[model samples]
Target: MKLLDPYSLVLMASMMCGVMSAVLFLVRRSFPADIQGLGHWCAALAVQVLATACYSFKGTLPDGFVLPVANLLFVLGNGLCAIGLQAFYGRAQGWRMLGGALGFALVGMVYWLFVVPSYTARVTWMALPLTVINGTQLWLVLRHGRRHFATYFLAMLVGVNALLVAVRGALALVMPAPTVDLTQPGALQGAYLVITAMVPILLSVGFIMVATKRLQFTLERRSASDPLTGALNRRGFDAAYTRELARLRRRPRTLALLAIDLDHFKAVNDAHGHGVGDKVLVRTASLVGAALRESDYLARFGGEEFIVLLPDTDIELAATVAQRIQAALRTACDSGIPVCTASIGIAAQTDPRQRLDDLLEEADQALYRAKANGRDRIELAEQEKRRASA
Candidate 1:
């Protein structure tokens, strides 16, 4: 087998990076602006393409121009990767720290390239900062990224890249090269160049995978949630019910459901238009959400009706929650656009065999009774009678 020359490998890396950068730039436009980081990553890949192009001209161009420029662009690319990861994870970008690090690394690279004139020193300077940047990216992925195959894949690639950079920096101290030219042919140099050529492609694949995972999650969330009120829709409620029922079955605990209906909701819509009605519904959902415990589940059943599932709660405790929601609605009415009150019906599952549909039917019946009895009061569903033994 014949080995490719270092110059050829460098040129290939530059071309590959340019293609990947363009691919990322196009892919980024498809994602929502709120989905941050793709822009930075795209820019990083473009900068890296330039960096490798400069390196490919090492023998042709003046060392003073090629060496410092290539190393600086390389470091800048890594720094941008770190920033992109931070943005993707919804963390502070810390631009000042990044600027300082890049400035410091550039000064060191210039000193080694011109003032001191040591190739090993320049390599060490470049590799060390890359190691730090890649390590930071690895940490962000592990700490903040979702536990998915895509997340772990990106993390693995980044972690290995960081390790390789650190090893290269360490090798510069232990095994100094005879020549200052990066294009010099040797086994280690070839291997390094090969890895440099391949990693950007691998990293881009990992990034796309992660972004795809994020898009999947976002779509799933939107499907399951009410866009107007930000509450779980009926589909989401059904899934939540299944999970809650399974959990309750394991623990042999009570599960309570509260069916809530906004009283005179149509009157509000008729009087103040849908825009104001939307504000009322959003405020009502917010208030109900605040009244419920963290473990409780809230879902928009349809129109002005919402449902709440409270695990490990009896009918009495569920009534207390209902009262709290009513109070919240009353307070909201006093302060906001339109006056609104919610009539709540409570039903509790004492038997593990009780199905979600049966519970929902009971709650709905009770809700009808609440509306019939007054309008803004709570009604408890009558417990089912056990069959008589023969």
Candidate 2:
């Protein structure tokens, strides 16, 4: 009985906005605090709360102002949301943002001046564009891997609202029937009661799911990552390496493995204390990560040692990569450290008979030789040398 009220639905929508605000706050903590996209989300949620509250107080507003004000606020909230989506996805570039903004402005002006005066006019045209813009944004989210949970949440919102609009549209066509009562809280009133009952349930459930996903990601990162370096810890590294090895088995291809050990690392830890050594480690990791392509994998194997996996790279190319990593680490600056160098051992999947574990052991043996012969140089696997000689 209580579910038939429109104001109840408006209150539920406002509650959803409150939940969204909490999600934005939690997500912001995991990322860099000064991110611009987070600010846009906060602004958009504020507008949505205001719009929903306006609808909740519709009976109290003056006659001419109610419809115009509520719909206008909806337009503002959705428009700002579109802009925020563009920015958050990093697609608000060049002519695309300009074009989207122009379209929003044009439709907003026309709706305000021409459509708001007559209720029928608003239903016939305004609802279609609203559905299209929201649906398009959901499609964009599915296309990009980032913010996929956000996209899915928004898709449910769009679909539910589109269904509401369609049902209302069908009722408008049969309004002249004697059985219809446009003001009643029933299906005869264009199923307003049905939408009012269902929309709040959908919105509330969807908001809860989105907030849960955001919180889960935040929790997983804190538990699985290194606090000082933002790199994967031992647990994370093992999981990633195992997954990569399985994937490599499925698609047979050339793979290069490099085992890197910091030269004279104990001297620094002894001379300057562990703090300086940690700084040097972080700086070295940053340099190596920057030098490699995004597809390449790097992980801290243990104290003062690292491992890198380069897919589709042969031994020759792996040597070149090892050299780049060495040169980059040499030039890398760490606070209160003079200079740092690394000795790297290079190995690759050259033989069809070699397994991932075999490749790793060969890389480890070559790393020992690199440390044995000198402090800072690349050592190739002996089998690789024999292949080249032949």
lDDT (C-alpha, whole model) for all candidates: 0.85, 0.66
Residue-wise C-alpha lDDT for candidate 2, range 267-349, written one tens digit per residue: 98999899888888888888888888887877786688888888778888889999998998888665577467888888887
Could you list the CA RMSD of all candidates, in the order they appear? Answer: 3.3, 6.1
Model 1 segments more than 4 A misplaced: 178-182, 249-251, 333-336, 384-390
Which ten contiguous residues of candidate 2 have the minimum total lDDT? 176-185
Please report the TM-score between candidate 2 and the true structure: 0.67
| Cα-based TM-score, every candidate | 0.89, 0.67
Where is the poorest 10-residue window by lDDT in model 1? Answer: 381-390
Instruction: Write candidate 1's Cα lDDT for 1-390 as tens digits.
Output: 567987789888888889999999999999977688999999999999888878778779997888778877888888898899899889999577678768878888789877888878877777777887898899999999999999999999998899888887778877756432347777777777788789888998898899889988898988999999999999988998889888877888889999999999999999989988998889988999999899888999779999999988877688889999998888774454987998988888867788889999999988999999989999888662121121
